[model samples]
Target: MDDIFHFDTLLAGPPDQLLKAQEQERQRIAADLHDALGPLLTLIRLELGRASELVREDDLSDLAVVIGRAHGHVAQAFDELRRTVVNLRPAMLDDLGILPTLGWLVREFERCGSGLRIRTDFAVTEQAVPSHLKITIFRICQEALNNIVRHAQASHAALSLTLTDESLCLAIDDDGCGMPDNSHRGRGPAGGTSSIPQRATSSGGRCDITSGPGLGTRIHVCWPLAGIRP
Candidate 1:
């Protein structure tokens, strides 16, 4: 399998890393928008028609109640927005590493009310995987789940990360309505699938996909850890 896809740093190195960094920065900005501006908006809404004295107040009490309700709605919106930010950049990926991060990601997916049962089989450890590889794997899983949520209307999905003496393998399988044809390469529900090969190739690995009209989609990516350049 390692011999199937030739490793090439030139294909997957600096440019991909730069894109990843930019995405992280975007997540940070999203968090800021949720944390800082969310509260400020709520405060503004509250103050718009706030009432000081309740006694002998002509309709001011009613206005305060309305403003309070508006503030509550703002708070709800802030929470939802914050969740979006977290989904974008998952802080756990940095603090907890890939395996735990994937676990959290799976939990998030389950909470989406999609009835998607994602079974995971991770046999790799944080201490063994390199930092860059960790990020790549996490991004792959993130995009995979997004694809499932958006297009797979399927009920069951599974993910596995296996590590050997010389290489690492990441596989995602979903029992969904597969692609219509090979010509619709980038049109599959797994829009991110098109980039999987590049991500693997850049990291001294290879990506393979198998799917059709009725056959479930399976994505397999393997990268040799032997001569991966920093």
Candidate 2:
């Protein structure tokens, strides 16, 4: 028989690492939006208010142009907020399960003005994964796709999930530029491809990445389900 199961031993360090990385990312985004863009937006609003007063007095012919520029800046700020929110946590992933969440991510990426083609080939059995595990898998998928979009410059990508008698395996493949020669395994201060393996290990699993220059990248994560009730 296999060894007895215990959460303390099974999920020792990786989840905590992931949580820390996520928090750091949140802080960075908050500082960028609140600290950097926030003041600029406030100033723009003040200028817009002053321009409005000038327009009411019919004293400034250029007021409309100033207002137009301010409006454009506001639009840009809103766009930045949207990007930051999506990066921090995809709203759909919280609302839906992994499958639908992944679908939503793919759609968002296609609409991201990046023109990358994403294909999915998942075969998960709808078994109820633990909440933490679910979140980890979702994030791993998100990071993998982001890497493909940001670095791979690849035209296509694929994702697959399968469950067997003993374990569950998920594979993400991309036809993009591969990792650099010196790339190492571990989550960076800002979560990236390195975090996937850590996430997998924390879930009593293992993750592997295979890639080379001009070749596609493939990430495989496997979690043992021998003692899991679900």
Candidate 3:
């Protein structure tokens, strides 16, 4: 009960503590994999290689082939684990900061070959964003883009992050076939879209979703600058 942040009431604790916990946990899990599973997987691959070599020297071609295949599978697993760790918590977010991380995220989606085009306009620089808000902004952008790519049939989308003297704002718009005003409005069957607003609220931000049957979708989220300080 002392963990101020609880989900039962749509974030009732301190302004953004729950999100901080979630992020810290992701970093922890990623580090654990890097420190533990990584070396174990490497050792497993080396052992399989040694077995393959021993079978080959014994003139047991079939056994050698089996051991070689096992080694290949182990190698593939090792690679996949590395990818999983990266997805858990991208290192660029910590090393290069949020701007580069956002750029990398956009580039990755573009490479997905979804035939969707996305444009970004950032009115604020890396230094302008509060440290506590960067990851929240990045995650909101990630979820919004995911929704556009998955549900919006239109090919063009735009993202903008800007800050005024008093508030910070993020907006995403798409040219796709928009949702009906009567629909769930980000609370529909799409869990991805639904989580966008939740994430904003968890960080003490307000989220707005606007769309009509054929008018496309627009998501706007904002926070008062004073409340977002770490």
Candidate 4:
């Protein structure tokens, strides 16, 4: 499989060497969204609202209705763009920490009305889990649920996360059709499925995925907290 890096980047150095570069790219993307696109959209909405007021003040009431409609559309678009930005990098991750964010994710997914019920058990305390590990856990859960919704056709799913003095374990199970035989170990045959194991490994964890005919899929990951990277 192709790695996260391109040919030259992969040959150039170890994965640790590329982490800084990857983070820089993320910062650049954040700047583009926050500094460029976000302000421009806000400006457009402000100008539209201003125009609507000006048209009415100028005795152009007939045109005011049309301008008002355009302003409403722009308002809707602004709300949608803000949501997109939040999803790109959830602000709550920094503001509220990881525990609440995970809870919010579960609740939000349930509200999606996909007819999928996800039961969540969070036995681990926020203080017990490392900051870096929390992000990893959240990402894995997000991707696994996405895959289940898109492919499993399951009506019910369960997520369990627990921590011990030594390690943390997470598992997601579904009652849908199992994976194809070609999928092995913790990796599925589907393209998106590979990321689960890859993320676990990169975070110093072990992932186990099990499924078959008449058996729904289950993904289990265990990470020794002492060994987790910052």
Residue-level lDDT tens digits of model 3 in 173-227: 8887776444353341122335566677767787776665666677788888877
For each candidate, C-alpha RMSD in Å?
A: 5.8, 6.9, 7.9, 7.1
Winning candidate number (lDDT): 1
lDDT to native, each model: 0.71, 0.69, 0.69, 0.69
Candidate 2 per-residue lDDT over residues 191-210, each given as its tens digit:
24355666677566777666
Candidate 1 vs candidate 4: the lDDT winner is 1
* Model 2 RMSD in angstroms: 6.9
Per-residue CA lDDT of candidate 4, range 1-230, in tens?
A: 12111111112234453355457548866776676556556766676767767776895655666566666666766776677666665788778877788778888888887888999898988787787787788878887887777777788889988988788989898887766563343344222334566667677887777676446677888888777777
* Cα lDDT for residue 200, candidate 4: 74
How well does candidate 4 match the true structure in TM-score terms?
0.71
True-structure lDDT of candidate 4:
0.69
Query: Distance from true position, residue 147, model 3, in Å?
Result: 1.4
Candidates in order, TM-scores: namely: 0.70, 0.68, 0.71, 0.71
Per-residue error (Å), model 1, residue 50: 5.2
Better of 2 and 4 by TM-score: 4
Q: Is candidate 2 or candidate 3 better by lDDT?
A: 3
Ranking by TM-score: 3, 4, 1, 2
